[model samples]
Target: MDFSRTHFELFGLPTAYALDRDKLDAAYRELQNAVHPDRFAAQPESEQRVAMQWATQVNEAYQTLKHPVNRGVYLLRLQGIDTLDASNTKMSPAFLMQQMEWRESIEDARAGKSVTALDALSDELRAAHRRIEAQLAELIDAARDFAAASEAVRQLRFMDKLIAEVGDVYEELES
Candidate 1:
């Protein structure tokens, strides 16, 4: 009910990368009902405007939290870590090497036209993603380890890009 509260506080969600979709949806509906501009139709123009702003904020928060990647980035931002910032693009060498290896393997698989190879890589990446998700939950929810979570977020971004590229390779083969 407090307009000044952040999205996590408003929805009573733990400040973590993993969220319960059901709870988020329920809280969003509740907030929409409370601050919907239509509910303030008889109020002054200023109050109605405020309601509109609150509604917009609530919607945006819901959108951001609903997606895993966006939620991770938002959690990083809350911790004052901007992963997308150019000047903040600092990652460990081992992580960078892993990214290079994945990209190379993807290229090799595509060039060989090996569907099995591509599928294997996809499965491997998905497994890695699962581990990353569990790590995010532990780091953010249990330990409050923003530093560790930020590292995982960086790696997850690479995995996400690699997975999308795999999809493109499959589409190319299909066509």
Candidate 2:
């Protein structure tokens, strides 16, 4: 309920990447039940407003923590690591090269209007996302390597943006 608390603390959950989805969902439901404005209808306007705010906070926390990528990024941010910062954007050179190659392939496929090529790129991106998730789990749980996790978060964000762009290209081609 405290605004200053991290999302995990606010939700009364462990600050780890591998979360129990069912438990998180149940906790979210419970929080919504408690803070839902409809339940505070008999209270004063101030109380009702407070209830609404709490409900919004609960929903936002539930959303960010329930997802793997968002959870990892949140953890990194909580650890005082800003993945978006230029100085902290130090991904491995190999990864950078690989991303460039994938991006070029996506552009080429889209330019040629090759649905098969686009599908292949999408599959590769999906596989990479899975691998990144696994690495995120290990960095947070097994290794407790915040530094590595921060780097992974940056890479994942890049991958997400690139994937979305690729999807946009596919959509444009279809249209």
Candidate 2: segments with Cα more than 4 A from true spot: none
List CA RMSD, all candidates: 2.7, 1.7
Cα deviation at 124, candidate 1, in Å, is: 1.4
lDDT of model number 2: 0.86
For candidate 1, lDDT tens digit of each residue in 1-175? 5777767888999876778889999999999999999999999999999999999999999988886777888888888888677676668898789778889988998899888889999999888887888888788888989888887877788788889999999888788
Q: Poorest 10 consecutive residues of model 1 by lDDT? A: 83-92
Q: Against the true structure, what is each candidate's TM-score?
A: 0.80, 0.90
Over 1-175, each residue of candidate 2 has an lDDT whose tens digit, in order, gives 5778888777778888988888899888988999999999999999999999999899899989977678987888887877667776688999999999998998899889998998889889988988998898999889989899888887888889888988998898989
- Regions of candidate 1 where Cα sits further than 4 Å from its true position: 33-48
Report lDDT (CA) for all predictions. Answer: 0.85, 0.86
